[model samples]
Target: MNDKKSVLRSSFLINFAIGLLIFFAFTIGLTTKVYIGGGIELYGTFLLALLILALNSPYVKHLSILSKNQALVLILIAWVLINNAELGRGIYERLMFTLFFFLVYLFISEYNEWTGFCLNSIKVLGIVYAMLTVFFALNTGLYVNIVMPVFADYTSIYQQNYAFLNGYLCGFTPNAAINAIYILAALGVCFSNVIVSNRRKVTSWILPFFLLGILFMTGKRGHLIFCLIALVLVYFINSSEDIINKYSKFVLITFGLVIVFIIAVQYIPALANVFTKFENQTEMGRIDSGRFDIWNYAFGSFLKSPLWGHGWDSFKYLFEPVYGYQINVHNVYIQLLTDVGLLGAIPFYCFFIMSFKHVKKAFKFYKNSTDLKAKRDICFALYIQVFFLLYCLTGNPLYDATPLFLYIISCAIGEYYYSTRNKT
Candidate 1:
């Protein structure tokens, strides 16, 4: 048994290392500029690692039993991909996303091992990113034009405009929306650790504050709001009385500081002026900076084919005439509606809802669990799902690899826990 566990651990670490490298490659320009036959040919290393892990994983034989909802979700994904292929648009992209989702499900179905590794990995990466941001801020004095050329291309144009705010913490991919997702996911892991362990480690307290600071500095208002909501939900949804008692004071103090900061911003002239400029950058009424027009256009496109919808990647073509450039609708639900229509969306919605249902079951199971590690694992999984669900409202998480990877892994962890509970 020990030997088997060792093998599993080794495989997971190898796969995880490959995944991190792939993430950094895209972020830092290693593979971002690499293309073959006029198409970006990244993910070769990630796919190979995934293939190896799948081969070694005992769960491969039981893939069909991974979750009660897996089959239905798979069918829906197939339907969408088929429809996109029929339209001769976005077939490659949709197919890649489908494969990535399947692999995440397969790997994370190992439950305790793979899921724990993933959660820890997220926390570590978050801390590393936060520290890097601080280091860069101090070294460069938050200069706008002091970017590493290799990493600069991965950031969004809007982020580039306020590069001073981003600092050098972005590593490779510095888009504010994406950074927000990373920070929130990491924070969820750390929060779960505190709750599950029923003790507050120094890292637990420090890491969250560091991540929150990074999120605020990103100037991504939508993500910041999502993070706040997720944090509050995690705190209340956690059913551990001991954990609550231990950290309740900290939570209250944090809220108090936030309120005091707001009051100070209003009273201090220089601070108020800075705050006003920040607000202007993130304010929804800023036309080009706002998502309202993009959402409206996506809705109109959805209305065009309410039943079947336009195929995947159709929004760019549909909206370019009006917006004069191609971009996502900035809302996952609206994007799904525009891409797959109501028919395809029904199963898609069911897939996510069912995933959350498993998470809910895991939460209840852990509430009564005696094992501290198991309890913490489920809590972390639940928090990650909640964060993703809320973040998806204002971001195209479906199209982004990092966020999508974390979301599916959380679902798989929940499903795994739910299945284990039933077996006993």
Candidate 2:
């Protein structure tokens, strides 16, 4: 009945709600199969709404520090509306996910302490996933060792791949390529901020090793390229005492290349066997099918509804009558344009542009910020944002919940840091 008691009660509820969200997220991730048929709606959307309500309690008046990130929010709203209009649905229907996203955005932005907790939680999740891999290895006799677990619903493709590169290891996430890209993004963040390289050599070594593990497990070409880009940027930005640039970036990269060369030379027999399997053509056939059927059809459909998209989740339906292929475009940009038309895409572009601008400004502040910790955090945010921008070009950024969460958190953190700086 007391105000203090009420606030405490609200806090407990909020924490419980968030824990549930995280749990379901983990469950859905591990299950790897579509629960479909309203299962997602009941468990996912309802709990999300409850979580939002708990956070919006009057007891927690100044919930998020999102005032600083208002520009991004505005841009995103504008884009969603314009895009949805093109699809003949209002913004509300087309961008339903944005509704829940803003709630999450607010919770993280308004609550300062939760940010630290969330960061630590990610590391915890990584460790839990590592354990799951061991469990999978033990339960199933598929692989020689228990390094990663196979999802109950996932195909065999995930367990068969193991080729490391650039210090990334992808142990979980059913779609290895997508999982690798996500890990690489996580690595960029952890490397930039979580670990203080100067304070501990072990932290530095662990960061790269985990990254290597992720890259090897995923076997995704796009992720490999992105990791290389991240390495160059992280090295150059962090290398303060060295030459104008970090030659270590070049040298390390060359070393990786040389290692690949030597491995190729020494294991030509094994490599030949792998290459022989590669020649089977099924993989290329599937890719070619996607390129012609999904990609091309989506492009043509986008032109028809250039102003607004056909509808949210409506592209496959719209295309089925024409292309006879029931499939997602597998490209975020195209997905956006098809689902919400040109009007929507403009706002989407604005949201992205503004988010990057804020990140850039934060990076510039590093030069003037006297606080070493603040400088490091800002630069770290910049690296994470860079990873998002680069990864979206090749993959549908919002297809997975992780990327959406990453973008929202980045904006939230950037907003708080910038606002606090201006206040002083």
Candidate 3:
């Protein structure tokens, strides 16, 4: 019994460390590169997580049985990697990120009881991220002029042309798209805390809206739309007749707050800037903001090599000559189809379909569950999954550490909940 307790404690600490590393990596956009190296540096939090796994190898068990959906995703990932092998080092980096997250998922699934540790760790990280965002927004000049320059060497992409009322608050990453997703994920964590009763009602209510405020500050219309949609889904899906009755006062108060915020925004000229920017950007001529041109060029390239397609990370190479500036396809599905062709896209599509199916099953199970915590966990996982699906429509969430790690964590928790319930 003592030995078992020690193992559990050690596992929880390791999981907590992993969670912290993931959040740190996401905040800094350190997903692909670590600075310390002569030729080949370590990449992201995966190496640290991998070392922890090695230390705990005795506790790690090989998965003897995979659900059909799980097996299909693995097959799809393998197919994508195998066909893109000619990309060499580029492909290897991508493979390592995927494999590291996969191993983390497997470990968590096997130790299903540790889901609480993961949730608490993420909640702490979310709170810190939210605080930083608020601070940066309030001091945009300081962040841009002082903080940003300090990390100039690590910055990958910075949009100098995009204008915002207060200047975009990208936190550590220069890419507003990545910053938007991080804010959304932080909101999900706050929402989960509210549902689980792990946080005070007031704190829970304020945190999400606060995070949403930062998200809007980033001027990412797609992310803001998808986040609102995810929140609505989470509320309706998890709200039972009894639960609704219990929280009716809280719900009414929240509704009142939204109304008050809207009225206040109209009176405050400064507050109206964000809304005006969004309205102006929605004009039919400016809606896509030049993405259509890039998408068209990418599609044309795909047509040239329909079957095998360009190699991994080949979109920029193929489009830059024609477009004059290097840009991604902007749409992940289209990007995959263009990069790997029809054959590779089959498995990629299958992976998402399978993942959704698994989450749907878990959602249904928890909806009927008598345990409140189980229901909250399921709802939280579902919200994150929705965010992932919606974000993929406009950005490549698969390649980024923030969204990918959150997706993996949510799926692992859901799978653990489903498996444990069945065993009982």
Q: Clash pairs of candidate 3?
A: none
lDDT of 2: 0.55
Give, for candidate 2, the lowest lDDT window spanning 10 residues: 161-170
Query: Model 3 — TM-score against the truth?
Result: 0.83
lDDT of all predictions: 0.66, 0.55, 0.67
lDDT of 3 at 58: 35
User: Considering only N, C-alpha and C atoms within 3 Å, which residue pairs clash in candidate 1?
Assistant: 27-172
Query: On residues 158-256, what C-alpha lDDT tens digit does candidate 2 reach at each position?
Result: 334432212122345554554554555546556666333446555565665555444444446555666668656655665564673367656776799
Candidates 1 and 2, the one with greater TM-score: 1
Model 3 poorest 10 in a row by lDDT: 156-165
Query: Positional deviation of 399 in candidate 3, in angstroms?
Result: 2.1
